[model samples]
Target: MTLEWFKSSYSTADEPACVEVSWRKSSYSTADGPECVEVAPTPSAVHVRDSKNPDGPQLTVAPTAWVGFIRGTTE
Candidate 1:
């Protein structure tokens, strides 16, 4: 199935800079702010784009790969 794109709730409309995340409700979303790097809602696969540049191309990747990337970057 094709996933629909969405913005991350964690993002603030106030901030000029926002990072779009592929959001999955409940699992990723919460009563609090949503996760970062919003992608199209779908299965394990995630499609990510920059909210700063809506017209920019997206990066598609598996959940594990995404996790590894974040882990690597933060480390």
Candidate 2:
């Protein structure tokens, strides 16, 4: 999958550094289906959003928390 970086628009003068995130579609996702999910992983956290609605609300979790979640699901 190609890496696509997006800059967060929530940056302000006080926090001039904008967050750049690279999102990737889940391997289980299909091109012609509705079960689309994407995840962006940074050093500190992981960001998740629905690929069907790119501009919709997103869910962010800490790196360790994300690991636990993945492990839980796989087992």
Candidate 3:
């Protein structure tokens, strides 16, 4: 499963600092399907969100937590 990375940036009204994130859709998701999930991994955290809604809410977790979750799912 080859994941394509796309960079996105967003800035809040209070913070002038621009945050950049690289998002990639899950390999299990189809091109024309509604059930799509995307993930962005940073140095400190991993962000997860729905591919259909890029501007929607996101779930962020620590890198270690993300690894544990992946291992748990695989096992």
Candidate 4:
């Protein structure tokens, strides 16, 4: 399955001439080049989605569930 990617909004340019910033996120690349995903967290849940498909469906989970998943992966 193809993972849709998204870019972080924190990127910026110092030069006034440069108006556009390239996509950058916690991403990895296949032989096919760079792919990314962005996460937005809320008080109640964490939201995840493909950057390339912003209008598409998102995966949301409770904050506790998210913490458990992270701890599980790290342990």
Alpha-carbon TM-score of each model against the true structure: 0.42, 0.69, 0.69, 0.51
Cα error, candidate 4, residue 73 (Å): 2.0
lDDT of 1 by residue, 1-75 (tens): 245556666678787655554443334444455443445634666667654444578788997887787699899
Residue pairs with backbone atoms closer than 3 Å in model 4 (clashes): 5-51, 5-52, 6-51
lDDT of 2 by residue, 1-75 (tens): 234566678777787768777788887888787677899887777889998888999999998998899899999
The list of candidate 2 runs beyond 4 A from truth reads 1-19
TM-score order, best first, reads 2, 3, 4, 1
Per-candidate clashes, comma-separated:
8, 0, 0, 3
**Candidate 3 lDDT by residue in tens digits, 1-75:** 223344335655677766566688888888686688889887778889998787899999998998999999999
Q: How much is 31 displaced in model 4, in angstroms? A: 12
- Candidate 4: stretches off by over 4 Å: 1-24, 27-34
Candidate with maximal lDDT: 2
Candidate 1 worst ten-residue window by lDDT: 21-30
Range of the 10 consecutive residues with the lowest summed lDDT in candidate 4: 15-24
| Cα lDDT, all candidates | 0.59, 0.82, 0.78, 0.58
Q: After superposition, how far is residue 64 of candidate 4 from its true place, in Å?
A: 0.3
Q: What RMSD, rounded to one decimal, does every model reach?
A: 12.0, 4.7, 5.3, 9.3
lDDT of prediction 4: 0.58
